[model samples]
Target: TPPDPGDRIPTGFADLDTLTSGGLRPGRMVVVGARPGVGKTLVGTGLARAAAIKGGLPTLFKTLEMGDEE
Candidate 1:
């Protein structure tokens, strides 16, 4: 089953959560766009970490730019 969209999942960053209006809502789309070397992957993995580790929620993160060998 999927998580309830009504509840929010914290991003593990207080500032981010605050900016996002109490974290991110489930079953919603979010896009983080920026230039290279600007910590885009850092932010993405952080959210995945928070959801999987802290929030105990199911998450899947795929990167088109990197491979397992990279």
Candidate 2:
């Protein structure tokens, strides 16, 4: 299905768009660097979830740190 003109766009990061021209565009790569346990994966997951839930776009997540518990 095609996107509706009245649809809302997900900015991924709510606080980020205020500083940039809208927000990250689709099919673009964003490199984020931070110390371990600083929520890098969490942020990525959150963005994917936001796009899926809020924007009605399908999201994919690949975790290199997967374990048997997952």
Candidate 3:
């Protein structure tokens, strides 16, 4: 069956979109974790840029070391 267009937020990466069956679904969580200085922030920013900019959707990138006031 074809995926519902409204159900996805394009990951911007072709491979990611394929692996995710179009893109990340609404109301789901995706975790990218690793040790210090391992490009975790790069990955997070890439996703956020893809969704919020190219894909024109709201995006959030949270960190354990920072908060709304930081």
Candidate 4:
């Protein structure tokens, strides 16, 4: 089925959604990259939270550098 018109998956921030012309497109892969202590984990966790909690979308978060307990 086709996606609903004007449907957008919010990034949990209105400002960022506006900047991206309505958040992320459906079925698209998004990669967030940055130097250490630069909020890469912050952003990834935030997005995952938004997708899972706010948008009710299934999300998977994985990390290679950090351990399960951090």
Candidate 5:
């Protein structure tokens, strides 16, 4: 069955869901900024993976720093 629009968005992290009173709100942007050596790419890739591969939602990732591998 398809997920309902009124249903909650899963954080994919149980602990985070409890802390955030549910999960990330729709139409919200999450920005992760750092001075390099951080895991920004990893997190972004993870989100894309969850949305596309896991949640079955279409995803688009545009990277200016790296070239596409596939």
Candidate 6:
């Protein structure tokens, strides 16, 4: 079953959570867009790590640009 839409999943960053009104909402899609070398991957991995480790939420990560070793 899907999580409640009103539920927020923290990203392990206080400032980010504040900006996003306590973190990301469940059952919503988020897109991170930026120029190259602007920490897009860093932010994405951080969020995934936070969700999986801190929030204890099931997460899925898929990347077309990176290989298994990366």
Using TM-score, give the best candidate's number: 4
In candidate 4, stretches whose alpha carbon ends up further than 4 angstroms from where it belongs are 2-6
Pairs in clash, predicted candidate 5: none
lDDT of 6 by residue, 1-70 (tens): 8887777889878899999888898877767778877877888888888889988888876665677998
Candidate 2 clash pair list: none
Worst 10 residues of 1 by lDDT: 61-70
**What would the TM-score be for candidate 1 when compared with the true structure?**
0.79
* Alpha carbon deviation, residue 34, candidate 6 (Å): 0.9
For each candidate, the alpha-carbon lDDT, in order, equals: 0.82, 0.66, 0.79, 0.82, 0.61, 0.82
Candidate 2 lDDT: 0.66
Better model by TM-score: candidate 1 vs candidate 3: 1
Alpha carbon lDDT of residue 18, candidate 4? Answer: 92
User: How much does candidate 3 score in TM-score?
Assistant: 0.70
Off by over 4 Å in 3: 1-6, 65-70
Residue lDDT tens for model 1, 1-70: 8877667888989998999887899888667778878887888889899989877888877666677985
User: Which residue pairs collide in model 1, if any?
Assistant: none
Where is the poorest 10-residue window by lDDT in model 4? 1-10
Cα lDDT tens digits, model 5, 33-64, are 66665776776676666656655667665555
Model 2, C-alpha of 30: deviation from truth (Å) = 3.7
Q: Write the per-residue lDDT of candidate 2 for residues 1-70, one digit (tens) a residue.
A: 6644444447577687555555556655555567777887888787778778877778886655557666
Tell me the spans in candidate 2 whose CA falls farther than 4 Å from its real position: 1-9
